[model samples]
Target chain A: MRNCISCQIKAKVEQRNEDLNAKLAFLTMPQPASFSDVVLFADDDDEHPVPVPAHKAVLANRSPVLRAMLDNEMKESLSGTIKIGDVSYDALRAFINYLYTAEVCLDQQLACELLVMSEKFLVQHLKDFCQKFLVSNLNLDNSLSTYTFAHQHNFKPIIDAALTQITASMDKLASQDEYTVLKERDLGLLLEIYEAYFSKQADTTMYI
Target chain B: MRNCISCQIKAKVEQRNEDLNAKLAFLTMPQPASFSDVVLFADDDDEHPVPVPAHKAVLANRSPVLRAMLDNEMKESLSGTIKIGDVSYDALRAFINYLYTAEVCLDQQLACELLVMSEKFLVQHLKDFCQKFLVSNLNLDNSLSTYTFAHQHNFKPIIDAALTQITASMDKLASQDEYTVLKERDLGLLLEIYEAYFSKQADTTMYI
Candidate 1:
């Protein structure tokens, strides 16, 4: 196959198989192992030292920068134990997968956990993705968990964005009879968020 | 294995596999057999459509919104026979895959083509990703392409952001050698962006 360098398309030719295999071989030379320790520690026969799936593992393998980051993270953890918020090993693994594959298969709780980890680890891209996801999927009743993440991580941009969205729907949120009951049950945090946002608005207007 | 909704992690599950699968299936389904008698078609068997390889088909199966947009585009093309841009059927397919998968295995030229299509289609997320990729991968000589994308898409936000970054590195970007080369090679567009941004800044200052 003739490969177009500009667009990476493969054109059919009599020597397609030979050309493709050659190109694949060049592209697949293990992409210069990013996590030297991970690579070194794993048995040669073992596919992945960390238990990520094969497809995702291949994606991770191709990204040398991401691999290096993971290696550095592991090294730091082993040497002095760096904390990624309240994330456990599982959450860290999921976050790594999300970074490499942009495919995360985790529960909302784990997603929140990974968002916290993304913040602690200074994974700005991951944090941005998480914030976007939260904003796109916000539900007033269920948003408390996401709000907590926004608050705790000091993801001020995300908090600002979410507040705009939630505040716009304040009447609908208040009208939800079931949610009103739940708010009555746990009014402290709810009141705190309201007061905080209102004060923030007041401060902005005062500045104006 | 149990699915997300029925699994022990039900409460935590943020996304379900079925949701993604359903979306993908919808995207891949063949266009209606008869669109006003034009009869849009695919070459491969309906059961096994053209497999553009996993990596190459970045947006192979995307959200229904994007798929609908593509279908409408195809229908419009068939009806009006107006092809203004360089977008081809294959390019549109690849662009869709890039949207869904967040990765495209196309070459730089094809990627640029897809980026233009994304902008035309109002796929802001894809446009943003493409712009970021182009900027990060750019060199002084090759940076013109990134600038072109910024100009064409009216991606003012990205352009403004890039200008801030580049100007912040004025010592590097505006060195004697670099400044002379850029002035001679890209003077028109450079001045345009400069004037637009400077005017915006002036407006903000006046308001302040």
Candidate 2:
């Protein structure tokens, strides 16, 4: 009887979940069919950048960084051309599309690129999504690089997660070629990794 | 062990649901912050209609009717002025806001008005939302009105649900003031009510 009652509660929650899901579906907007009032350019596209046309309202709503730029009547807003430096055309496209639809097909590389972009734009949702993707995909091979990236982005959850993954595989980490490169590129990061490993070791000893 | 596995599965589903909810929040664009290409007017506010400025992109993405109107280079598209007849300023505002946000706090009257608006514009999500609200709020007092409203809008689910409620309270339905109004204004609706009641009776008898 108790399990049956619990099952009934679960069913009710599931129904509410379905309702929320339908609401989400209804809210996820399709990309504009036309009538765009702003254009974004990924500088990597060179002299004649491929312009991503979008509505200012959408850009402003999605990103506080973009909102400030648009609202302040900045050079980019006035000239009606936003040149985002360092991002590839594809990344910019996916980023803009995500702002419109809140959907992205992420690979490891795309996830990293978008996470960085999401941070720059102050789009926390996309940042969280990218962080989750990277965390899920983290391995001994990628953990150091991910840890560095997460550190660069000022992501606490990601740092803690990556450090946990890195510390767990510290022995194998020393054997990896990338580990040697990381030590050379950023000794600080290597120190932090060792520190996390030591801290975890101390915690284990305390447990014992 | 079985319960453990089920709990793990439920946890995963809930995590996915959270991801989807975050996506929905990100995708819900705030109504246009000044760069509006189209203005909507409630015809009831004829004297000095307070124009609600909105982006063509948002309007087009939300409703096919709006998309067609904007894309086909019609008069409304040409002037950027859409005159929606038969709606109060409040209903029109709420309707447009719902188009942007997929959210509305609905009471019965607003729900009915929005249902009509949603049907007219082919916004199925809003129509379903309003239909759900009306059905959930349905009772002996509002059953005939809801049934009539559903019939006019060709809402099958609401029609069936309202009919069920009405048929179960036939004696009470006849005594209601709105019943007298409906019987006089639309005798056909009364005939449909009797027909539904008889049909239900036959089905009940067959089950017995």
Candidate 3:
């Protein structure tokens, strides 16, 4: 009986996932007959901004910051045009597509760009996604820069994960080019890393 | 390492589920400022149909029937009003909500109603949901009627499940009020049930 229930639930979940994926076609293949009520522009495109056509309700539903902007009869709500500053056209397209589909292909650069956008917009799920991507892709080369970026946003998960990576191989990390840049730009963060390293050392010593 | 990957995938699924739920708020809470481009009317409400405000993209995206209606410069596309036939206002709302959120609270009656709507609209997920609901809820009381309903729709899963239940307790099913109704309405289905029962009996006899 329990197995039957389990199988039922599994089937239901699979069906729902398929349905959700089908929903993404609305964004990917927007029929001209379907009305798009709003357009978003990326800040980097100053001369001829290519409008990313979207639905206001979708943007408002996905992000509270966007909801507030659209809800308050702000310039964006009245104009039906939202100009997203500090975002490249590709990142803006990816972000808006994610709003509709909740799926995005992320490289490290794109992940970093999206993580900032997610933080700025208070899109926690996207933030978590980007954070996980950064964490999983963390290595000696990128740990310092990833940690710095995570610290700027106060993302604790990425901070902790990156810190663990950094402290685990402090010897190799200290000799890297990015580590010198981090030490010069943010000595406080550098000191904190050393402190964490010694604290981890103390714990390991006590156990030994 | 395998456990870590499993945990990451689980977390990603949970985050996507949450993001999908958040998207449903657009259907539930439509701000006048958000500019809903279409209104849907339920057929059951003739006097003054409550307009279910929605987006064309959402409707067209969720169902191919709706997409065809809106895509070919149909009256629904031109007028921005869709009249959903043979559905109650509540069911229409629930159906649209499910399109946006991939979530619904289904009772037996609502599940039946949604199943019919799903079939008409070719919404496979909702049909699967309703089929699972009926299958799990199958018993002597509902098996005959459920089998009839499933037979009408050509829903094989529900028909097979109902057959299993009916054949398992043929004596009790034969004495029920619904059995007389099923005999009157669809004698062929009753014969099929008996045939299935005898087949089971033959299998058991062969084993013995």
Cα lDDT tens digits, model 3, B92-130, are: 988887776556798877888899999999887677778
Model 3 error, position A69 (Å): 1.1
Worst 10-residue stretch by lDDT in candidate 2 chain B? B26-35
Clashing pairs in 3: none
Candidate 1 residue-wise lDDT at A101 = 40
For model 3, the stretches where C-alpha displacement exceeds 4 angstroms are: A1-34, A168-175, A179-208, B1-35
**Residue A93, candidate 1: how far off, in angstroms?**
2.1
- TM (chain A), candidate 3: 0.85
* Candidate 3 lDDT score at position A179: 80
TM-score for each predicted model, relative to the true structure: 0.31, 0.91, 0.80
Tell me how far candidate 2 lies from the true structure as C-alpha RMSD in angstroms. Answer: 2.8
Q: Looking at model 3, give its docking quality level.
A: incorrect
Q: Report how far off residue B73 is in candidate 1 (Å).
A: 53
Best by TM-score: 2
* Quality of candidate 1 docking, DockQ: 0.01
Candidate 1 DockQ category? incorrect
* Candidate 1 vs candidate 2, TM-score winner: 2
Write candidate 1's Cα lDDT for B27-107 as tens digits. Answer: 221222111111122232254444332221112122233334334455532352222245555765565445434445665
The root-mean-square deviation over C-alpha atoms between each candidate and the true structure, in angstroms, is: 24.0, 2.8, 5.0
